[model samples]
Target: MKKLHLACLFLGTLILAAACKRDTDFNYYYYEPADFALLSQYLNLPDRPENYQSTLPKHLQSLGLAARPVDYDKATLGRVLFYDKNLSKDGTISCASCHKQELAFSDDKKVSAGVFGLTGDRNSIALGSVLSFSAYYGTDLFGPSGVPFFWDNRANTAAEQNLASMTNPNEMGMSHTDIVNAVQTQPYYEPLFRMAFGSNQVTQARVSEAIAEFVNGIGSYKSKFDSEAEKTLGYNTYSNLERNNFSGFSAAENRGKLIYLDNCASCHSPLQGRPEKMKANNGLDAATVDAGVGGVTNQANDMAQFKVPTLRNIELTGPYMHDGRFATLEEVVEHYSTGIQNHPNLSPELKYGYQPKKLNFSAQDKSDLVAFLKTLTDQELRTDKRYANPFK
Candidate 1:
């Protein structure tokens, strides 16, 4: 009887070892020792998110905002999901397909291409073109405190926005069940889901939440403007003061700063990098080709009103506007300087006596404005490994 018991224990140990070996073999094909090490760090325990108070310039820190607590493991899982083409119906498109990192997470095309080569109705909005995503959307949950998302302000949160993108027939073309099945079928995602959620179970809600957390981590603050602004945080009082030229700027750039402050700063705040109004009709068309916010709200007054985007990384994100009408900075400047049409629902700031007001900028003014706009580009964000595709 003692010998029989000992034999049974030995057999059980052998089976357990075999199962562990098989699991290791499955992952070894894709993950190297180094890759597993990276994965383990992200999985076993998550590092704290970057400290905004230390990372951000004091000028931005003064905005009375704090970073919301996010699970780093979940965000890492979200990063993989963001770049995974398997999320799409045909396995060709990913979140990264339309929103490229080099272009400040925006697309060069007027409208992004979707699954089956179908075109989207609107341009891909730049995700990281703010000091932090929290600053633009606010730390509040779905409520009056934060701005709604998309050009039309239709979605309330990043999760909602991602869900819309995934289900859109022309976009990812995945239903909730399809998305879950796709994620479950991927062997790589097994450990990712396990690490992120403490189990290898994939759910639609988990997928959306993880992607949302990853996107919320996206931010661009290390620009030429930030470098210059950091030096003056002690006394310059950037938002309230009569803006002065930065010591680091060239004469043309300084001139451009003045033009931006005097003419453009009312809409696009210089220091804060947030627009005064969340949505406005920028006089893109004399008549509303797309009803814009009105289409979402079913309100007459909201017609043609679109979300005013932050100008961070404006240098890289081009073929600008919701429709991608303007191709160059010069053309964009010229539009604001002279091309604003007398639309019925044009913002009050753009109207003078109920007509679109032209700035009458000279060639030099336009050139300088473009120069100043270039300063807003955050070079670090263009190639940050944290935001890059993890699938290799």
Candidate 2:
């Protein structure tokens, strides 16, 4: 009897080992494109974006395009530039100082406290989904990518993205000359600068270029839904709650989707680009307020208009809004559901059949929407070695 029990135990162990082996085995060539038919009727884009006339709205169709390949050295230099403190006046703050990696590249403070411990007007936007801004690409003649970088769409490129932050007196507060001097004196940067720009001397332009590469690389597409959407990859540890959350919202959120399409799709893309373009201000407050893009242009019509950020990982990167006005996703939904203050320059899309300022979401409906948003979390990205801090 004892011998028989031992044999059974050994067989059970072998079976468990085999199961573990199957789960751990990875197949690389599993990914495939989504079916064209399903996306065509709802999202309304061509099967091949390269051949199709893009429906990206405004100048986005014209602006959005695939990024050209980058040099490995240049991209590496950009990573270094991102963490370097010489860019700031006091030589104390680096990009990572505010956009920490652990918090998914967002500062936890309601408003970013910068160089002199001065408070910023708005909360720091996370670095995720930043590189996905192809919709507003080529918007800037100088730094085409920078135009959409700031709270008010002020920066023109990722290279120029730090200009205001570094010199804002409240942020880095560093003068251009001071920054150049610091970089020039850094012994470790010489080879990196030389490799990136074919010279050891660091210049402002080189700094910008390197930083942009790193920022662009900060992008991601994998998430609970993204993986599930790709049947070839199969499923991993995603919970049933997350899946059920998506299905539950497939109805009500479908209504929200229609609402978003007629009203907000021109900017915050639900299905515009490869990953989906995002940007739009849904009349958050009364006119004459911050005036998001208008703040950059000083245009009256642009009042209260801010760039529509990605709903990707939207569940994580908040308090909410450029100003961090809403504390919870529910609050943001409620506000959009009802609280948009009427204004003269309000977005025309929000004019009729608008969701009231106090959206009347059922408890279940609100919970469902929140669950769908949580599926956007890319658990892998947070743990991936490529994007993780090298020091760790």
Candidate 3:
């Protein structure tokens, strides 16, 4: 009986190993598109009706960050729409044109160019950290305390934001009718729409919702910082040994982490919704030409205030700030350290009354901060086949 049981166990292990290998092999081949009809098989697609939760880092989970469940069919439809240049009126550019997957869904350009070489006034915010953003949305980062979307706080929701960009003259250059007409002309959208919505018909709302679903699915939780922080008592309460002997961080990086917690965490807290909810006037200018949040509210107090973006993947998403004024993290650190201007509406966190307060970080401190920031980059996100271009 013992011998028979051992033989059965060995066979079960072999079967499991073979199944894992087959799944791995399938993923490698599934990405190679031969025809549109293959999409019907749902190869390489996430399983349906299974609530797909974003894989948040342990630290975030400890902080009570939670992601909404995503429907695989909806997200798949969104993937198709995200890569389809046909969504644009001229059929030359897609949403992927500005939000490239390689760069953490942010353009490397200071200001991204739109359809027909037209340019926007502000830098494109990275959409890759969608899990964090989604979890914190409708909290302080978006409502009651924070302005909703864009550098200027122009749109309220991701759906509204997408529609705005799609219709903007400088962006995809399409009207509502244009978008519907464009999608209607594409035969591929019929099957995708059917799969997502249980119907072949496409609507403007459906298009926006599908794209937003895809954007929400983009998330990063596999960074070096995430791995190290998971082993410790989160980012705020690292013990000496945990700080000094973190798996992949250097001494300088560890020191920088302490500095960030002390000086930056009020606005960029890893656990709280503070990072997304708070907007600050980092004293960019004494009197700013661009109003930022003030532009949307037309309030003097809100002037020069922009949403504080998440620091995750901050290394890849540059040039930094609303206008992409600073080209490097060094420059950004320097600005906070010594270059803060005394703007009337400058965030109190960065000022004493009306006077801008300098952090007075040394040169080495700046380098260390930049080093630590780079640790936030998620290598897996850069190459994740789930978020890659699917139109090929």
Candidate 4:
């Protein structure tokens, strides 16, 4: 009996030591108890702003689009995956490596450096800079039309985009099988996968879906522009933009708004109105060096055309344009003001009689335009703990 009791005690000690080892292995990062709770607060939010429906123009009211919902548990898991550099082949890059939170989830580099020090061809597009991802890509913001991901509009869904980035040689540089192995090898992910999918089994599909859910949960609606827009109910039509002066804005900001409404809003869209055009050749280059959408579709009409991303948080997200060519907002405005090159596929809005149309913006016009653009900056999104890095 004495020998049996000693044997049992020895086995218990081994088990305890093994449990401690497992805990220490996963302790490289710490996730709080509160962080583990789904809360169901940040994710699963409405696609549009509260007053969005009430302020829609009569013509736009009949779209009959429903908001897409996000899963909180999945998003929580995604937050971990986004920051985990182990997802990369060399264990040096993650989704957050390219898309940083401080710069509105955009990289400040002209072209982001990926795993193995390879440089990407284009700028890192900002995520969650404008409306919620659901509204921006879902039925409402684009007016019942699905918005494709990436500058070239190659991927139709967020999952596809995430997978593409993971597999891209210049990005994560991980195969689907490699990605699965990486996640499975991590000691911390067992509980995360169980919490997210009710199973500890990790898969590429689940990883992409969870990351998309987390991304879709991110939003930037608490800006000065949103505040003023709410107070004024809404600015539904392009015609009324100049007529209404936001009570909260300074004269310079209001002046800039007029300039933006007249020149920029046709594509960017103020408030929540549908942009007149989604993709356009903004005359970045005279000749097709990159070919942009044309490269993806092999269609001549799509040449030099790129996704016209929303200008929200334009202050933080720079250098501007798909190639990150322009270093400052003034440079961007100057492009439209005097530097629009006559690309063959130039959008009609930028062309007058086929020659590059110059706005001839005065110094005051340029300054005010920058001022109005700054109003779109949302401090909440930049500092929100919910969307912050879960690993400490």
Candidate 5:
């Protein structure tokens, strides 16, 4: 009996020593309740403001997250919330009320209409492929960390971006508290909220987090242009017959290709993840009507500048430009062909100009150009199960 007791004591001491020494070596960062509380209050949620870790993937972390992942269910809920009209002040608006999915997340209106039929100053933009890129704020407001969102790169993170739209009088025009209340009161949301956040309790921060998650999940890639480029650039997807068509494509597409490469590529650049990201002026108006980046910078040089949207899925995300100003690819091509508003900030690539010196289309050229542009669409993204509205 004494031997049994001594042996038990010996094993207990050994186990205690291993727990203290070995377990201490492995450091697993975890979220404290206080962080969620702060986020719920909108106190410090740039996702990585103050280097806050995002639960994003390692590749995403290389893009820069401290070390936390965005909540997936929360993001999915945010998608439904985004398209939901009840959160608006007048119930006439939802996030999609301005940013339509058919138009690649943009509205057809030149300026978005808001509560009381108030029209906004700028055009709506498409919303997808959010995770592939980094945030940008002109003055390094994120401190050489990352670029923020918006035309001027204003909002620092997806959470903040969601909050801005909710409160903006010209947008949803709803209070954050009201949005939280609307979400929390729903029986459907409570189960989803609990599953996503470990608590059924809903709040503004979780709402923003979910919206950001949905935004991050929207990835648009594998366009037709991308396919062709991939084949040519050695990505290796085309058959020999498709490759044989390459010469004809080059002969036919080269003119349009040059226009795109020289002019459009600078901003829409190949794939969103590439290092040298693109943004553009596309010469809509040399004196951009809305004062794009200028609003954020107060700098004359940055006036009328908007982030260059991905040409991927261009066929679907139309009524083009920052104002939904051009409804068709031809109109957009022509703008670059000759309609440039000739301002100081206009990119120099246009100075050399189009092959015909204008994008005036013969029926064939227009058809070919459109075909080439259509290749930018990724059917998979449009049909992605992840991006579908959960409310339905």
Candidate 6:
């Protein structure tokens, strides 16, 4: 009886030890309550400054362009919405799926995959420096300076753009009603919605607005180029020599800057006063299938026109162009140097009389051009925790 009692005690001790080990393993795999509390702070944000301007360097601001004020709560709400896969029909995709923060908020894929493994038609355009969109495109500020959104410029505002993506069958595949229901069902969204709109009610318009505020808050100006540009006189006052010999740039990069100014600046000027007409047919083909802006306007003259994206983070946001045809900067340089075709509505900037003019850049010039483009990369924007995924 004593031996039997001792045996029972030993078995009980082993069982208790095993239970404790299992509990420890479970705890190790899951996030702690403290970790969740810290993450929740991102979702339930504090009030933002009413007149919050972007963190972009002062020297980079265009003369007449004013920074739009940001509401912190709204933008924080946007950040959550941007990353939430629950917004999709199957809970498989989010805005971050295409516009990844690591790639300057652009996709590495030539075309991004949407919900259910469907691929988008065009390469995703990078969302870096989107804060400048309203200032550059708003009709009240810069008359006819920019179009709505997308490669074709179909949507009028960032909110409209977000809605288009969310509803598109190939993208998020959720309707207005469905989006409201989906968001409402998620427990985490109630707090976010309340913070953003002062109520926990989820509406389609409010969703888009929150997402747009978040997108519009993203800015990139801490690049090597901005650093160098700031050290010189203001963008408007810089002399040709000062502009070319920007501080910290190597001789090759400086030479390439001159080449860019001479050849590429009319359409893609680094300084302010962007072209009034934002879209251009960059002589991609003599005849093309994609009607671009013409598809929206149904104007024959607008055929083949596409929106001109800012060159702020061009180095990381490639393969270049609307269709993502050119995989490398060298390929892009080659296209401009020799591959320009004669399209009837080609921009005057790319034309010498009736023929599409070739840049005829030498091999060395092409290499230097690629080197200079790399200087535009903003390292801080790539790793900034504020824009990072808040969800564990």
Expressed as tens digits, the lDDT of each residue in 272-320 for candidate 2 is 2332322345667665567677777888776666665666566667777
C-alpha lDDT (0 to 100) for residue 198 of candidate 6: 83
TM-score, every prediction:
0.85, 0.69, 0.83, 0.82, 0.69, 0.84
Best prediction by lDDT: 1
Q: Candidate 3's residue-wise lDDT over 30-124, tens digit each? A: 22244334554433443332233586766667666666567766777787788888888788878988888888999998998888889878898
Candidate 1 lDDT by residue in tens digits, 221-244:
888888787675534454554366
> Residue-pair clashes per candidate, as listed?
0, 16, 3, 0, 20, 0
Error at 233, model 3, angstroms: 2.0
User: Candidate 1 local accuracy as lDDT?
Assistant: 0.80
Model 3 reaches what TM-score against the true structure?
Answer: 0.83
- How would you encode candidate 6's per-residue C-alpha lDDT over 1-392 as one tens digit per residue? 99999999999999998778553334431223553454455443323322224754555563455556767767777888899898998899999999888788998888888988898888898887343544554444344555468888887778889999999988899999989998888766776666668888889999999888877777777788777876774645445543558768998899888787788777876553234357899988899668999999999989999987667777788877888888888898898999999988999988999999899999989988888878878887788676777676
The list of candidate 1 runs beyond 4 A from truth reads: 1-54, 138-145, 234-239
What TM-score does prediction 6 earn? 0.84
lDDT of 4 by residue, 89-140 (tens): 8889999988888899999999998899998899999985546665566322
- For candidate 2, which ten residues in a row score worst on lDDT? 49-58
Pairs in clash, predicted candidate 1:
none
Note the Cα lDDT for every prediction shown. Answer: 0.80, 0.57, 0.75, 0.77, 0.59, 0.76
Rate residue 84 of model 6 by lDDT: 89
Stretches > 4 Å off in candidate 4: 1-67, 138-144, 234-242, 272-274
- Most TM-score-accurate candidate: 1
Per-residue lDDT value at 118 in model 1: 93
- Stretches > 4 Å off in candidate 2: 1-65, 130-147, 230-267, 272-280, 353-359
